[model samples]
Target: MSKIDEYIAKRSKQSADFAREYKEESQKLQVAVEVRNLREELGMSQRKFAELVGKPQSTIARIESGKMNVSINVLNEIAVATNQKLTVRFEPVTA
Candidate 1:
């Protein structure tokens, strides 16, 4: 692994709290990337995407920046607005 990845893995093994927070932050980052990608694919600016999704531009900005804990209801609204399907599933964790 790379140096940063190695460090994170070592620290995660050493501290349960760090591991939990890391997982949470990783999930948030995944969501942020997906949302940003979707907006780009739709050729919409943040303001335009927010208008389409019935949210404020600031909300979109926060979500894209991984600073917002987005709700499923809002995600569903975004999906409907973008004419895309949103799917959620549970996966087994691997070490």
Candidate 2:
């Protein structure tokens, strides 16, 4: 692995709290990216997407920025607004 990847692996292995927190943040980021990508793919601006979801532009910004602890309800709204399907899954954690 690269140096940064190696460091992250070491840190995650050495600290359960770190690993859990990192994984949580990573999941949030992935969701944020997916949301932003969906909006872009639909050729919708944040403000337009917010209107579709009945949220303010700032809320959409927060979700896209990964600064919000987004609710499943909000995610569902986004999925409906974007005409996309939402899926949730769990997998074994790897170090």
Clashing pairs in 1: none
| Cα lDDT of model 1 by residue, 1-95, tens digit | 78999999999999999999999999889999999999999999999999999999999999999998888999999999999999999999876
Backbone clashes under 3 angstroms, per model: 0, 0
Superposed by TM-score, candidate 1 places the C-alpha of residue 93 at a distance from the truth, in angstroms, of 1.7
* TM-score (all chains, Cα) for each model: 0.95, 0.90
- Candidate 1 lDDT at 4 equals 90
Candidate 2 C-alpha lDDT tens digits along 11-76: 998999988898889888998898899889989999998998889999999989988888899999
Candidate 2 weakest lDDT stretch, 10 residues: 86-95
Model 1 spans > 4 angstroms off: none
Which model scores highest in TM-score? Answer: 1
Query: Which candidate has the highest lDDT of all?
Result: 1
Report each candidate's C-alpha RMSD, comma-separated, in the order given.
Answer: 0.8, 1.2
